[model samples]
Target: MYEEDAQLASQDWSLHPLGELPGVDSVTYGIVTPGPHQPAGVPLLQAGDIVGGVVDQSTPRMIDAAVHRRHQRTSLIAGDLVVVLVGRIGDAAVVGVEQHGWNAARSVGVVRFTEAGQQHGISMWLKWWLKMPEARSRYLESSAGSAHSTLTISTLTQLPVPLPPLGFRTRLLRTMRLVERRMVLNTRIAACAMKLADAHFVRCVEENKEAPRPAAVIADVGEVVGGMRRSAAIEDGLPVAWAAPAEVLRHRLAHLDRTDQTTWAPPHAVCAPGTILVAPRPGGVETVVSRIPLVPGRGMLALRVERETDRMWLLHELRSRSKELVSTAQGQQGREMSRKAFSRFTVAWPDSAQVREPFARIAVPLHERANTALEENRVLEALITTEFTEMAEQTKGKR
Candidate 1:
């Protein structure tokens, strides 16, 4: 390596073998210190902490306080960097104030930057580097030996990192942080908007209480519909906007995939867009009834609304009764909805078309908002992908 590269070879901002990095320390596990159920004492870092390249401090398991007293050596500080040492290993994050209750173990590591050359921008810079596609390539190359695959501290320390000027690193971190802040604000706004939509829907329903109604009974899958066949040709084809059972829960009509899917041929006729999709098999299982709209993969039912009923109104009604619907499925099939139990399910519907106009007025804005949100997400993903790719390429020559 050239003289300029020598200084950065093993530290932050330098492209050197990670093993040569200064101040490297491996993680020690809490197993030897104490075990769970002893008492809520010290917090423990697990492999799950680095999810999608982010340290979710919320998941750190709490150890007995007594354990902390014994394992003072494993204590972590806010500036320390933690890395996963087990499955999917090598994922790393900077310990934040939120991690005060936590300490590293044998399965984790706490690496500190060398005192002589540590920079404030180093942490965020390293984080951004780790998220780059090139870094992932390096991680996969090092972890190829394991079936579950993991990055070791030794391997991570050996990976090459670009040594951009400290100011540049700071600029990059600021830009990324701005994006993150905006994302959080958007999330809050989206949540509040959704709540407003829900409240409006409920108010409209209550106001129309005196309208003429259709004769249908609200029932769970186990009460009326039977389970359909599970076999279907799964496809990723685009489905037209639909108001199916899933729509009732999602509160938005979106396309379902026809391709990349198994063909679900239910014994009873499949319901149309204005119908409900009930879990015929069961609930509480790791199944996605809400993600299915058109034809469901077996053990499901499609409840079509009567022509006189408004699709949106029926959807909101199902949403209001979601808890009741899911609960009724309990004790049916490991907490699932059975088809035989859903056959008799019915609901009260207005007999006239005029009753649906009110629902239509309330649904228009929601439909627009859903479409807007989906488009915004697609655009954001594209923007992030482009920006990250460009940055990684710019740093490629440095490495």
Candidate 2:
């Protein structure tokens, strides 16, 4: 490897191989086949299970204990850092107390730590280290070298771990915890706001007795447009934000403030603020309203709702019927929602503006509240990454 290719840290600290770290007991991948999800079974954490730097155990894929037994090597304990080896490769989340004894899916790699490691917070530091911008870029670069873009367990085991002095590492992590706590608080606030909006929508729907009418071009709404595919050539100069299907499907939030991918796109691809974005998931369509103007990537469609008040009403309308949106899908997989399918999907749109106004009055503030929390998180995430980079820089080339 070239000197520049190395993930550098201070010369004062020795770089240890991840698998050989004093705290890490073993490094291994999860089960090859978990079979179908079942009730009253062991919860299995997949690559997608890690969200926002934590394990989202709310709706984990439950597999038979028989299946889990075969993968006893990957059974998780509190503070064991789980890393994604496939789709969303390189993402890491520390196993929490709630998910103790749960197994992992095929695409996930479990880094089991010695009891001493857990007490020393080694797993958590590694998890946060992997999330830094530089670390992520390096991992992405390494994974992109493969045709299938995967990070193997064997490869992960050999990863160089920067060994900062124990005292300094703990102190820095102590401060970083404060930032993480604030982030968790914001996430909770956003989640509560979202639930409130959903409740309001449900109440509004229950009380309404008006007949549903077709959405019109001028009266109530506009047309539904498909997202355009972008290439690397047009994105060589200034960066352009493009929301990919994963971003929408994974988040599935009420409103989107920023996008993940970057590429130049056509005018039609750029969705105006408040435009509803719909993307397909495993069993349903995931929808969110764009808070800023940005381009939508492949497998994404934007619904143009000109009226600000109408935007909130339609967002909940589409979200509530997300499962039904797949009825118009063309394939057996049922994971793609084309523009034709969604355009044909009947939304509970009222022909008169006054009808939607009542629901929007209650829903709009809730959406704004949720979005406000998301915005703060966006800022916090950026700041946290920046802080990580700065902290690392402090140790660079130091004696």
Compared with the true structure, all predictions reach lDDT values of 0.51, 0.75
Model 1, which residues run further than 4 Å from truth?
1-13, 16-63, 67-99, 102-119, 138-160, 208-385
- On residues 1-399, what C-alpha lDDT tens digit does candidate 1 reach at each position? 243334533344445454443323332333444576433456777656654344666535777777777777667766666666665455567777877647666666556554422444455455556656777778777766565456665667777766554556556667767755664454445445555655776776677777654566544222223433434333543333222232222222222222122334433334343344554222321222222345443434555545323555555555555545554454535344555444444544654446556665766466446545544644554565566677656866666
What TM-score does structure 2 among the candidates reach? 0.87
Residue 310, model 2, lDDT: 75
The model with the greatest lDDT is: 2
Per-residue lDDT tens digits for candidate 2, residues 185-290, read 8888988988888888888777665655545331226567767675555533444677877778778457777764566665556677887888887778888888
lDDT of 1: 0.51
Report clash pairs, candidate 2.
none
- RMSDs, each prediction? 8.3, 4.8
